[model samples]
Target: MFGKTINEISLNDTAYFEKTLTQSDVFLYAGISGDNNPAHINEVYAKESIFKERVVHGLLTAGLISAVLGTQLPGPGTVYLSQDLKFLKPVRFNDTIKAEVIVVEIDYDKNRIRLNTICTNQNKEIVLTGTALVMPPRKRMDI
Candidate 1:
């Protein structure tokens, strides 16, 4: 199925999705991704690092952005073209991260849109910020 088609979308449109990171989520991600860095699983090892404790993988946290884009903003049929991200803070277990996407530019002829992506923690601090280029569904798809 598709979300809002290009014709229905407008600049400044926004969407949000959030998740509370847990040990299980991190472990599953680590298992699937094979990123067994000690900082993500070994508490003792991470305690010695700057974070002072285990931290969730940055990419894992960033996935929330994908969730928003693929399910809420441009939705189901949206095709992500590119993204530029900056990790501003460490995401620890049990932190609730809210991901948001806002339309900033649109090319009707090209069927492309530029969105500002941002992730914030429960404390309202920005953990990640980025921009993405995507092509929303050309027409609604109902299956």
Candidate 2:
């Protein structure tokens, strides 16, 4: 009821959201995911590690994509089917992340859509890329 219906949505429609990750954000995500990996939570250990500093959880950044899909692109009432993600770079605390999604294909008959997803850091470096499959809202007339 919140997003564009299948008939109203078109190919190339896009949406994006940005967030600056904080140490608190990393800690909260780590606690929720139970990923107490030293590289993410312990500065000393991280400094000793190859990254030289705590690296934010990859999935934590990826979650931004889900936020875009749920609140913007296909919007509410959309059902996420599947997603394939590739991690291209590491995200550090305080990195501003931009999560974007573009509609690539729409199957009106099946009421499904395929989209390209991407997340970039402040420097416009690709941190993640992927494709998502989702069932978009049904057309009001058809329903």
Candidate 3:
């Protein structure tokens, strides 16, 4: 089914992409999203917190999934309808994180799809998991 789906549709079934989390990424995200939480930016404060180190924003990992969905898997012309996520582990700076997405369901009539999304670290520990609903480009033209 994987090979067939890949040939029939442009959407990707499963993929792995990695990025090294940096202090700059946290700071940039903070500046752009107004999420200047100490856990995300202040190493000293983070050291005293439960995590004992700076942790990236949960939304940051979630955003990575959106990137894969919009740019790689379903690619362009895909409409993001909704997403649900659960943060399982903390993501620390300098950690190499991998994000993956797989098609779970497809609604042909509405051109909608459901994908299983995941983010993990180099140790293969899952940092996040979720489901996303998107509208991929249809195979047929509508008048």
| Tens-digit lDDT track of model 1 for 15-75 | 9999999999999999999999999999999999999999999999989999998988899
Which candidate model has the greater TM-score, 1 or 3?
1
Q: Compared with the true structure, what per-residue lDDT tens digits does model 2 show for residues 1-143? A: 36667877889999998999999999999999999999999999999998999999999998999998887778887789999999998999999999999999998888899999999999999999999998876743221
Candidates' C-alpha lDDT: 0.94, 0.90, 0.79
- Model 3 per-residue lDDT tens digits across residues 40-129: 888899999999999999998788888776666676556789999999999988888999988888776677778899999989999999
Predict model 2's lDDT versus the native.
Answer: 0.90
Q: Highest lDDT: give the candidate number.
A: 1
Which residue pairs clash within candidate 3?
none
What TM-score quantifies how close candidate 1 is to the native fold?
A: 0.97
| Alpha-carbon runs more than 4 Å astray in model 1 | none
Structural similarity to truth (TM-score) of each candidate? 0.97, 0.93, 0.87
Q: Per-residue error at 126 for model 3, in Å? A: 0.5
